[model samples]
Target: MGTINELLVNIEQYRLLGYAAVFLLSFLESLAFVGTVVPGALFVVFAGSLAAKGFFDLGDLFWFAAAGAILGDGVSFRLGRRSTIYFSETNRLFKPSRLARGQEFFARYGGASVLFGRFNGLIRAVVPFVAGVAGMAAGRFYLWNVSGAVAWAASHLVAGYLLGTAWRTVEVWTTRFGALLAALVLVILGVYLLKRFFVRRGRLLLAFAGSLLGSVGEAIITNPDVRTFVAAHPRLCAFLAQRFDRQRFAGLPLTLLGVSFLYVLLLLGGVIEDLLASDPIVAVDTRLDNLLFAFREPTMVKLFLWVSQLGRGTIVVAVALTVCGILALWRRQRYILPFLVTLGGSTATALLGKVAFQRPRPAGVAVYREWSYSFPSGHAVIATALYGFVVYLLWRRTAQWGQRLNIFFAGLVLMLALGFSRLYLGVHFLSDVLGGYLLGLLWLIIGVSFAEWRRAEWGPVSAAVPFRSRAAGAVLLVGLLAFFIRTGMRALPAILPANGAAAATVTVPAAAIAEGLSRNRLPPYTESIAGDKQQPLSLVVAAGNEGALTAALRSGGWLPVEPVSFTTVARAAWQALGGGFPPVAPVAPAFWAGRPNDFGFARPLALAGGKPGREEARFWRTPLRTNGAAVYVGVAERIVGYEWGLFPRLGADLDRARDDLVRSLAGSGVVAVSRKIALSPPMTGETLAGTPFFSDGAAWFVEIRP
Candidate 1:
């Protein structure tokens, strides 16, 4: 295989000859006895790899392979046709058992065997012979032969082509990055398989859900208040009855029990998959961590840092005990079983998964860290069980569908947010969170089902005394609603810049950098100048005065650029629609010093055919200065006219922008000296949308003449 690959790579001049080689090899592989000794699949795959590199067209290769296969089978069929009349089952050349098996296959599958047998390597050779001896019609045999060859050739060739592409991509990425990308591909495949499993078993799974819902409906109808309400309003009761009426509710208990077992199996499957690292859980987890790391800022850090405390070990214990107290106070002896099952089972499950998988947590300074293995995240499991059980309690208490829905979604949101908190705080991978969620949900299902069954067995008890006064409940509800409303209101303004050119600022401790500018000397600046979705600041400078720096940039033909906002973005779109250069383009935030760019500048361009483009640079004035000079770091990239897409998309070419900036500065003669410095190592990374880029990690430093 190595030699073949080397040969294909070295011989681009004779790529046209690959078509003939593919045809001849595929023919020999399909021929009766010769096919057994030949590696036809290997050669066809080589052809595919060649096709990938533009040496041969895959379309022509497929046709040639298919034709060769059909012809080979046809020749085998003729030999059988001539030889059968002269020979018997006792002939030395024909093994009676092999021929009998072929006969049996032919009898069972009829002409279809000709098509299916093509995939069974050894049997494929003999099937054509057996068909000929069986006196199958020549035309019918040819039809199946042609159909099977088409499928076989196309599938094998396509598989080879894809594998070839994957191999090359892995080679390139591994050289630039590491083994992470390769592992990620496996993880992604596993996740895709998981989704497929659910989809394929959707109906079977839905039956379990239907049974659970049916049980809940029965429980509601059995309530005394619900019975009284139905009696009082017969017409309304009838309408509701008609909507839910089903005769299949008779054997629903057994169905529910069966579904509960299936849930156990599914959860077990997830655990096994995770432990084996055969699922995309690990890859998804790593990639998600990388993605979240890209967007980290002090604001988000503070938000999640606070929210994550809800799942702390001390908090979990406190909440669990508090719930036990509430259950005792409510006089619900039966409800205690489910609460215990959910809480206890979740904790145990999480512990077992962690120990079994022995997966390590992501590396970072977490809000709080625990000295334990990190497979199933305890926080995710606890939230799912605790909050999920609360959902069940609310679900049982509320008869109205509207109240039930609100309760369900609220509990769901809380659980999801708790899981996200672990992810954002860099304590857990996505897999660990998912594993914990799955485990908790599994236990929650079994516990809730058992609780319902027990509740049905115990008969109705008198309602518990009110835990709090109606006024207190009202006050609590109002307070929660008000708090959420206020939170939502404040979220937008707190993070966004108030106006263009007002750089985002953060207070730096005076003692943080002894050799650099202190907090008192640091200029207020954002991480990047706000235009074009936060262009990153790649260039930094130290100048004695702001006036000199501004004048130097102006001499270099860099005009101070506008900050991006909703109004500016809209105006730009309007200008583009009218076929003109946009005055302003919105930039997405790129973080530095835990904030966005503080300043922006640009130079206009007119390309061939009067097309419009701009070379823009953004700078963030840092808290650090050199030799008592104010230090500013900036990045430059170019945006051509918007590319038409689902929505108009901005076109960027960073390398081109960098070159343009360099040429402009050199032409202006503003710099006394300029040199390149290796700021970091060469690396390959992708944007959030998966647009890949490579960087050599060089930065240009130009000292401006005072």
Candidate 2:
């Protein structure tokens, strides 16, 4: 087991080779027999740290990790399959505790355990061997195996690469950079994993009480009617406002649940501003005097005018908002998170736009307030986005259309109020408000689309982390990461660039920042049968569950073939990349091949009645026909997209075509798809790089078309 710091430094020194090493090491460690002895955590982080220095190819990471993983476990599985267990009785004498723990972890999390355990410190090696010994289905194992390896490799490498290059100072802040690096590794890995699981539930509700209670609370926050109603009901609004500062009121604990939401909101505002800061077209108007003079007659809102000037108020507001966010999380107010995500996404974008475009604000600007750079109004961006998200989280919970309508209208009212507040105060131009609204709403749309896209894939929420002594510490740590990382200057630039011009003028692009977050930030998908024709396709598969999803293809006459890892397929494809002849990777190769990786992952899928699509496999097809037979199997979110040469037919549906297949599986017999590849990047507009592919819970089996 290599220490993380050594890995990081080595990777930094060597660049891409380091990533390849990491990719190979992580995979083998996870797959190798009793290999959990390998230190996966530190290795991955160091790889990431090295990647951050800008020398690695992130795309190849999937294959590298996957290959390493398969090989590692291949040996273990081979050992278990070939070596009798009786001989292992004596092996226990030298069995390290870590190996035992790895076995225990495997037992605990199920097949997914092998996947997750590989990433969680010293457990990587032993679990895969144990899995191999259990004779776990190779396909399923590979699916998870590939996924785990990809995630592990990407996270550590990218983290180290991006943060290492961009914000290495954070490491310097402490004497023990290694310790800091380790802690950072844990946080980065943890946060990315969490984003995939329960958090992607398409914006859940805030249940301060139960894993279930906050469901409705979420509806309240995102619903426009609620916002409107609360706004209209000054008394109620005032009550909430008054209680906002209260951590606890009466018997009900107004705790950290709401705090997280607020924090996200604040970041969103600032982030949006940052996005908008660079664009000269996006800058806020600086002509303060004329703008303020017009508002003189409106005495009703004068008090807030002074508050806006202090900028201190904005800081306070930002703090309060962050506190609200933490409270929301602690309370299991899951619903708020979607809206928060939208807000965060938009604000960040807006800020990026503002700063990137460097669009100066309208000049001869208003005197009411000394304004900073702004193309779109942060107030406006947040108003439509954050409030809209709030409303979205609120209204979706109720079945009542009337309530939904009410909240929708109310959300509109609140948005208008905020928009009016900004305009009346002469703080933002009409265009600024509109641009903010447009951009902010765009974020909401994207967030909502993402939430909806991932809804089916979202699993049950994790049990909430209890707010204990560590809660504060955890928060402080996160804040330190966010703030210092943001503000943290690196010695890299100073060290590399000559003094005057090069250092100050050339800003390193964000894309230059290590893989730009996890390749798995998005969710994954299962096979979609929507486009499959009802033609009886001959499925050549081995027995067991292999026949379960074979549609009408019967195993009675089917030839038995040895199962292989998907990596075999990936390797073949990688090799075939040199060959121009494309391969139609079947949907759910395991359905036909017994193991998940046995045949073309999508090899078995075709219009059964028609001539075989691939000439190579045409000879294998029998004149078999099953009407309305369907097979659908479900898998987890993973990095499982077919590369272009692998699936030439996968045009618009590459990202979503798999889901279409899943839907088409109603009458199908067996659907043995892999949950692997949930963490890999998307190839095209067919899918974005950020999202992963997760399947619906079940792949409905029905006789359907390919």
**Total backbone collisions for each predicted model:** 21, 194
Model 1: ten consecutive residues of lowest lDDT: 523-532
The TM-score, computed over Cα atoms with residue i paired to residue i, of candidate 1 is 0.44
Residue 272 CA displacement from its true place in model 1, Å: 7.2
| lDDT at position 297, candidate 2 | 38
Q: Could you tell me every candidate's TM-score relative to the true structure?
A: 0.44, 0.24
Task: For residues 508-592, write the lDDT of model 1, one tens digit per residue.
Answer: 2323332232234432222211111222233556555667677777887887654443355446657766776553454433434
Candidate 2: stretches off by over 4 Å: 1-292, 301-340, 362-367, 459-706
lDDT of 2 by residue, 585-654 (tens): 2222211111112222233333345322222111111112223222222221112233333432323323
User: Which segments of model 1 are wrong by more than 4 Å?
Assistant: 1-287, 290-294, 297-301, 355-360, 365-373, 460-604, 607-612, 616-637, 643-658, 668-706
| True-structure RMSD, every candidate | 19.3, 28.4
Count of backbone collisions in candidate 2? 194
* Global lDDT of each candidate: 0.63, 0.44
